[model samples]
Target: MESSSPPADTNRASTAEGLRFAFGTLTVLPVRVARWDRAAARTGMVCAPLVGLVVGLVAAAVGAVLLWCGASPLLAAVAAVAVPAVLTRGLHLDGLADVADGLGSGRPAEEALRVMKQSDIGPFGVITLVFTLLGQVAAVAALYGQGWAWGAVGAVASAVVARGALTLASREGVPAARPEGLGAAVAETVPFGAALGVAGCCVAVPAAGSAAVAGSAGQVVGAAAGAVLGLCAAEVLLRRCVRRFGGVTGDVFGAVAEVAACGTLVVLAVL
Candidate 1:
């Protein structure tokens, strides 16, 4: 009798298809390449926050482990940053560059976006990338020096909360510049719950810590303030992009994540 199981080639193809679907549905990778259909894109948009949660936890766990291993606060912070950077293979950074290049060109929105879609890097892109990276490094370093655990919390919280901001932006924004792309799919399909879940996770981190010495009222305030500010900033950016570019692009989303993360860290530091 013939085996009921699928042939090896068929099984491999099935596995590959599943992997592709997961990647396209769970993160910004589909946004980058513009592979998602309307429904898939929406599903991906909703999954973005959950992706951030996973990323945040990974970052936090790494930072916590480094701290436990007697690593300096700075080193631990760096390790935390490194985890997500590696996981996403700097895709967000690329988006940042594209946005910077487009914004700096001083061209019309359509032309700027055209430039952004190309693989070339302009002077503005280079400078913006440097400044953004430096700012993040310094901010992380400063927070770590003052309080490693709090710093870890800020890092993780920022990562997750930023995704929430992104989701909100996608939901409220216009369509893509072109007829179709990740932006369009995201706008059409991203669920509201994904953003809520991301925000919840960020809030829960500090709330859960309310029992520990490190989880004082001040820390709670700081986390809450950071999240609020991040969300607000993201909304402003989203509105501006919708008006200027006619919709949110993958680059805009990247910019939103970076801005939100930075804003959250600043609030945490101030608080």
Candidate 2:
């Protein structure tokens, strides 16, 4: 008779696989995800912020180089905003647009989800994408106008928080809207406390470093406040999507990330 516990290697957790899964699914990065099981999803969600960190750094580097090359803050900001889109192949933006159309359709859950899966974007999607992109560019420009360092900080901080929001969305008890797809694969893969721990680190680490560089306690407070507000905005959207759709979907995750990034950028620009 076979033993009850199965093989030791069956569910073995690998950080490398986790990173690959995170980068592979989240970005246009070439990393191959070797596993598609719950174990992989669990590790991937927890490591999502690492993908954000790299994306943010790339975005910041582009903006900073542009600024150094005598580009206007607006132009640099546009580059900064565009880099992540290019890197992720605009996956999150499309999700945001789709989500907007779905929610804006005012139909029942099934109909709305069907609308979301369609190839063509509706008027609601177009309008939402326009304003959201504009908000991001404008906010990045504002931060850049202050200085390159501040602008870099804003780009990096917002990206990390945005992806961290995904981890929260994937935590235990968050059901998937459908029986298949990414939402279902990664649904409830993370422990709630673990998600919170990751989120706290995402907020605290960047805020602390940014404040130190700025040489002000106020900057620390501002950074924390901005991150907190961003996460709060994402949380609101997540709940709304869950309630409206009956659970979370991959599109919902994308929408949540974009909203979190936008919120963080706007708040950082203001404060």
Candidate 3:
């Protein structure tokens, strides 16, 4: 029998090593982490979207299968949208809800963080989840109307772009809300260049791929623009999160990913 990979608690670092940590920590899939040190976490966050690449591909496959079965666009869209949430155990959506609850509470920073920590969802959280999920469903459904091929492109791109936002959230100057936890471990570990490179690579993938599939430079440009806009939207929310909660946290990363993804889908449909 083959030996197992190292346990998740070990400390190590490298892009290759980071891939294990990223998949293990971010997804329900059982990719073993090489180690869990700060180096691993930083690289893990940097390589975060690599996990999304697989996620997007899987989501595209799910949508494609539903369409192949003669399902309506809306039905196919719902399944496609649900795939990532199911895979990630709804981690990003939960963060968006927590952030909504925290900011909407209109309390002080410490109080807001406390509100987010609670196990129960608040009214703000509930409302945000409803609208955000609705927006994703609506947008993907619209894209599917164009064709399942188009829908597949949008689904995969949106997944990657959403995960890309987490890298931006970790840039230098972003503070951690507390002395310990995920925030403290990953915050500032990804420099601006690393974040920019990751974002550029992610946006480029769909743009280049779309051009090949749809055979239009305009479509490629539009997809690229939508991805950038999605990242910008996430940045706006990140600013609010910082001002509201005193800094970034694991929850903040999750919130940014979800919102960015939704925004990307909306733009993809319209553009």
Candidate 4:
């Protein structure tokens, strides 16, 4: 009789391939993805939070080192904010700027998307970028002033939460804005259960850590509150995107992630 065991090696190879795709697409990380099919793309988006986890940790590490070296909180915060921008090649920031320009134009779906696709930044883009960056810097600085640990915590939490928003956007029934491009490639590829499971883990891990040091109940509640608010911010943006553009695009995905990060940081800083 022959053994009926599953192909463990094949499964492992597939997972590794998926991870490479995720990091390659989501970050400036030097990873080569060998596959580009629907399954691979779905796996990549599902695994996006893993990239966020690494990015957040690196960002926090930079801020912590600077603070230890006697840098001011503001400077450290700026460095922290700049690290993600550098790591992702400012892709998310660019998306945020483009989406801002498009929405601010008050044009119809096609016109708005066309405006967003333009290479040049508009006045609305510039204004949105300035305020958003300033808000992130200020929030991180506030956390840093409280303590380096707090800053680090907030950094990690926000990054993970932001990517969680992307996971949300990737779920089934979330239509793509265009029939081509990144949106079309990965749109509605993620199963609702997968998105929910990843999102819950992303939201819960940080909250659990907070509970460990600062007592269970209050810390958990605070983290939950922040996560809820962050998700809400992303949801509102998603709704508006659907209304204005007919569905989420690659740029809209990035915009949701950035907005969720900002919302998470603001909530953490306040609470």
Candidate 5:
């Protein structure tokens, strides 16, 4: 029998076409970067809050189920942590470690990026990740134990607000450290409005609910405090990244998201 012949270029073209068709649904670009075009950016900005909404729903559902199942608050908290890790495939955590390593090394920006790109984790990265996760776990467990729904809300809100930070940072003339990547795409798309919308939805919705829970104005005040803290943290990180790297990278964006999330959680827990 004759040997089978390989597929022709037409087959390759068809495969490429299929991939292109699937790209729209497979990517999370719209969340991190709004569109540079006015209309597209607006649409993306409007949809930006939806990411938080989804994360919030997921956290709430899981928390409810765990509570109902009589799991301890600690276990429930662990579940909350697991949700995002699973959803994003630990991308933010990896970014956190890499960014910590880069920042701690006192190396030049290029060298920092090179170190982050390496697979090995440095001492700074390891210590930061450990403490960060411990803090998150403790905060979640404590809030849940106190029967406060604000923890779940904060988790979701952080997702949106963090993206908002990333979007806003992109607009402030931060070049993409790499020639092409998610950072560049985000820089091209993220507009101011999307960032604003995200901040509004995250802070406002939670504030309203918190006010009802407290039966006083303190809830709103607390929520505002949390929002401000998160925003400030993001801005500080953005400025530092810009000064150090001359532009933001995907890793830095990830770092911002992680920091904002942690900062929001800390503020909520304290207040």
Candidate 6:
């Protein structure tokens, strides 16, 4: 977002650092992050969707291979849904559960944050995890039932949108709830315009590709609409987190990603 032209070498180095930061922080990948400052975080947040693309492709590949092996749609869907979780080491899912418990605790902000930091999941957390996982699996299964391509497109689109939501969440003015940890390290690193531009590009490519594959105008419209609605859902949760928890945390980021991904899958399945 900084418009001042820097040296080409510096630009290349920064981009490499950012990519390493994005992959290292967001996934269980072996990439080592060489920098943790705002400059790297800014680029990393912009590159978050790229990480999602890889994750989605892996998930799609697993499902496609399972289907080719004569596995049932339900089983393939389960594998697809499980792939991202495994790749991320279940961090996003755990965050989703923690956020659910925090929000549902009926405690004050400080107390709720403490509740979320506990080692064990509360009842609300357990319930939220169960429903979210079930919803994702069922929706993917429905798409797989339609056809392998449809399911693959849905999986990839949902993942890309999910990570794109993280980019949006990192935009300027979104404060970190605490002074330390991941949320603090990356919060407000991305510029608002940059975030939107990245999100628009990420959403458009998949939507257009889905349409091209399906050979239907409706598919493009549906995919775009689904992405928009999913982002809106995540934004609502983000606002709530800011209001209730004081601002965003690492858990909030994870919760936002999973919610956006699940919402996108549901919309894709229906439309």
> Highest TM-score among the candidates is held by which one?
2
Q: lDDT of each structure?
A: 0.65, 0.88, 0.85, 0.83, 0.63, 0.87
Off by over 4 Å in 3: 1-12
Whole-model lDDT for model 2 versus the true structure? Answer: 0.88
- Residues 13-84, model 5: lDDT tens digits: 232232222122113323332123333332343444455456656866797689779998888887886676
Clashing pairs in 5: 34-189, 34-190, 35-189, 36-189
Worst 10 residues of 2 by lDDT: 1-10
* Full candidate order by lDDT, most accurate first: 2, 6, 3, 4, 1, 5
Q: Model 3 residue 118 lDDT?
A: 93
TM-score of 5: 0.80
- Give RMSD to native, each candidate: 9.1, 4.7, 6.1, 7.0, 9.9, 4.6
Q: Report the C-alpha lDDT of model 4 over 1-271, residue by residue, as the tens digit.
A: 1112111122223677778988888898899889876777778888888888888889999999999999999999999989888989998999999999999999888889999999999999899889989989999999899878878887888888888888888788778778777766777777899999988877885686567546358766787678778878998998898788888777898899889889888887788
Q: How well is each residue in 74-116 modelled by candidate 3, as lDDT tens digits?
A: 9989999999999999988998999999999999888888899
TM-score of 3: 0.93
Question: Model 2, 155-193: lDDT tens per residue?
Answer: 998899999999999988778888778887888888899
Query: Which candidate has the top score in lDDT?
Result: 2
lDDT of model 1 at residue 22? 33
Off by over 4 Å in 6: 1-13
- List runs of model 2 lying over 4 Å from the truth: 1-10
Model 3 residue pairs with clashes:
none
Q: Report the lDDT tens digits of candidate 6 across residue range 1-271.
A: 1111111122333788999999999999999999877788889989999999999999989999999999999999999999999989999999999999999998988888899899899999899999999999999999899888888888898899899999999888888887777887778888899999988976785687578676478878888888888888899999999899888888999999999999989988888
